[model samples]
Target: MRKITHKKAAAVAMAAALSAALLAGCGSTAATTDSVAESTSTAASESTAAESTEETADESTADEAAAKNCADLIDAIYVQERTADTDARCEAAKAAWDALTDTQKEMVEGENADPEYFGRDTGDASKDDPRNEDEIGENELLVVSFGTSFNDSRVADIKGIEDALQAAYPDWSVRRAFTAQIIINHVQARDGEKIDNMQQALDRAVANGVKNLIVQPTHLMHGAEYDEMCEAVDEYKDKFESVSIAEPLLGEVGSDASVINADKEAVAAAITAEAVKTAGYDDAAAAAADGTAFVFMGHGTSHTAKVSYSQMQTTMQTLGYDNVFIGTVEGEPEDTACEAVIEKVKEAGYTKVVLRPLMVVAGDHANNDMAGSDDDSWLSQFKAAGCFDSVDTQIAGLGEIADIQQLYVDHTKAAMEALNG
Candidate 1:
């Protein structure tokens, strides 16, 4: 009985020990599983945070790329040459600009592209017509110019001529063309206005099936631009039944400096009269008597037609207007240079000088070169010379004058007569 009792006790002890071991193992297994689960959860959270950070970085990079693309596009279209892709590039530039956010637009920059390129108020473009419309009748009068980007000047000067032509030739359709592709591109990009280049304008005329075409150039003289315009018109002459290009504002550029024509005299007389009146003088003689001299600044050209400036000076001399002077920005004739003109004015003993642009439109050359505050500008140079008591500038072009417009009208009439003859 004692042996059996001891055996039962030992068996009981073994069973209890086994049960405790099993319970301890289960507790350790549960703790390990919980630790693994916690580690996995922490790793998942880290992965999610890393993904978000990468996404944010990618978004930032994309925005920067978009802004850069917009800037580059603007730079691409701000060019002088028009290609098959020019229109498309211009549209792309506008689109890219539109796509940029406000912050991105503020960051935009390029060689010729800036925030104000399309943002600046250059007057209401709608006030002026592009004259690029089609569906023309038989007779088409195409008025061509070197062109200006200034909206107000364009309307007052170039459009003034166009309107006059339209009114004068009510039987014909008047169109417009610019010789400077740069100006055309600028107007297009900045103001959403498209002025046709010479080639485009001629092609447009041919496409319109116009039988009679008269090209009236608003150029100041027969210079390089005039030559190029003639070349362009020559190509399309066969397309029209009759094609005639009228003389420019200065008429035919004579062979030499001594060759003065009626056109030069008219221009000299008209401009001087206008300047004298604007300066509160009764006439050129009165202005001269008052110790004041008028200096007319022209865009001196390298072409042989540059003699026209010299001829104008001669015409002024012939008119006995000793106080009136002629100068050129390019200093082509050497005598008409700003320095030379200043010496002439100083030697002539003029106390006051009034500067005016002799060019057709009071555009860049008139505003900046003739009258700008820059040191190299004519106004600044005249002031710096200390030769005059007071220097004043008239920011007016020849095209603004009624007499000048009449001269164009007369030239056009002559061309039209010749075309019919």
Candidate 2:
């Protein structure tokens, strides 16, 4: 049913205006009988139009109320209302899901009808509120990421970064935002954890009268997401007295490879340590000596920035870490695909392999594409190659690493210093 919108309200007002004009016409004198008949006929037509419009307005009011009910039901999927209404909200959400058309369902891109929508209550609704408090200080630090919907990853990776920033800069209140709307929706519907987007986060900073603002992005590199985050900060540059943005986890990509080289070494150290421990080896050297190859799987894109993956591989090799291999899901650099990676490892005479995500969060790509039991998954294809004796995976994101967290803190410090400078 189509809801009565502002357009319908305008139509009702137009009908009322027409009725008043017809009344005034009846009061006017007609020069001829034909003129009088024509005026009378116009009055009848106007009266009919007014009555028809009133009937439509009445019907639309009911439809509008019904539409509101459906919208509320859809909202319940994401919102954690009062404690007492939880059960009723779940039931209403189901009913609303059933009543929605395909178009309405598309509007709800999250898990709206899931039992978990009302199942696991966090017990505090205020925690999920974007604008939890109206109180604001002069300085604000907004942390942004292309977030993960996985609850554990969200807490371990995203929250971990935010907590680090908050501790590092006690004067600046650290708020959170996610670039991925789908992840935001999924998290809200699945765990009732509401997060702000780029615009909303910026708007909140402005509304709170924050003068000095710093945007710290937790992205891995200066990829598409990072570029977009920079654009958003630039778009709202005038909203604050002074606004600055930090370099991503990895610093800028330039002709010189020092920054990315440093990042590659850091990641290599962090993940190699985890993979070694997971393999029951003493250390990275021990694992390397044992002929165990560590594969870092990144979520590659078709963007020109795909060279980052290739650059990582080069950095590793230049650092003399022959045991480390880098590959991507989309095979962006062409040679990083599962088949190509398997061939490389095989040619290198490595019989054991350990896989981990090169991404900030070990979410969907890490869980399914890399390690899942599906026949076409990386682990599966590697196993099918009949070369390696053992294959393992580490399900931790880069954000979970302490050294990586400190790296982000260092970047935040630089950005803040630049702002102060």
Candidate 3:
């Protein structure tokens, strides 16, 4: 009986020891599994933070690139549209500018290569000029001319006429157009001055939705340049509600001497007044009496309108100014050639001569052809003739005169009346 009881007690002790061991092993396994899960959670959080930072950096870089592109496009369009190649650049710049969103467009500042830049008179125009206004008028006055590349002359001569017209017609917006592409290119290339050609000016007017347009030519006569302006006006006539053209500075010459007589007389008198002032004479008669022969130089052409030069000579004679002689560079009217003029001045027994340009602008013909230093020029040829004791030159254009400007203004009024009639 004692041996069996001891055996039972030993079995019970072994079972209790086994239960304690199993519980301890389960606790250690649970702690290890919890530590592994915590470590994995921490690693996943760190990877997510790193990716977020990289995404923010990429967005910032993209914004900077967009800003740079907008600036580059603005500069490219600001380049002068004179040459054919540069015009292509302008077109491309325009395309790129158009592609940008409103947010990107707002990024562009100074230099004004924006949508508002078009048809906005941003330069220094006169205060009285209607073009200085922000709101453009329905009626537009386009002043067309064979443009000069000279910056100062272009402003003083061409802009002068436009300003006058703007002042006269306060309701109209005065714009500029150059018929000569070569001059436009020359000015832009030489001086970096940008001017609108015939097509560009017309395009701007059309874009602005101009209703009434009147083209007043600054040309001296109805020559080839005038004819070309007329053709351009005819092409775009239907674009406007009403379009009319004004006569040139010298008015019309349709077989009526009276119509152009006033211009010739005014030019002759104005030039004589200026000449006498330069010669230190009291008046035109005084200059003629002092044996100072005034030779007015003109830009003669092969156009049928060349007869205007002959008519001017006849008008000068009718005004009883025999000392004043008219000559041309291209030798139009045959009698107005430099050589013929020289002989005529000698025959009139003039000892001294005054040379001046008869054109509206004292440009290439006046500066280089008439008064240049080259041996082939008119000044050199006149000096070579050995006809006068001394020859003096006057560098001034007809457009500089106040009366000439008024004449253009009058012609514009007449054209408006004619269009209304």
Best prediction by lDDT? 1
**Residue-level lDDT tens digits of model 1 in 326-348:** 99999988999999999999999
lDDT of each: 0.86, 0.74, 0.72
Candidate 3: deviation at residue 212, Å? 1.0
RMSD (CA, Å), candidate 1 to true, equals 14.3
**Where is model 3 poorest over a 10-residue stretch in terms of lDDT?**
125-134
- Worst 10-residue stretch by lDDT in candidate 2? 113-122
Residues 192-286 of candidate 3 have per-residue lDDT tens digits of 45567788888788888888988999998889989988987899988999988998876666563333467667767776777678779897678
lDDT of 2 by residue, 37-111 (tens): 555566556656666777788766655555456556656545422345544554665566556554444344343
The count of backbone overlaps in candidate 3 is 0
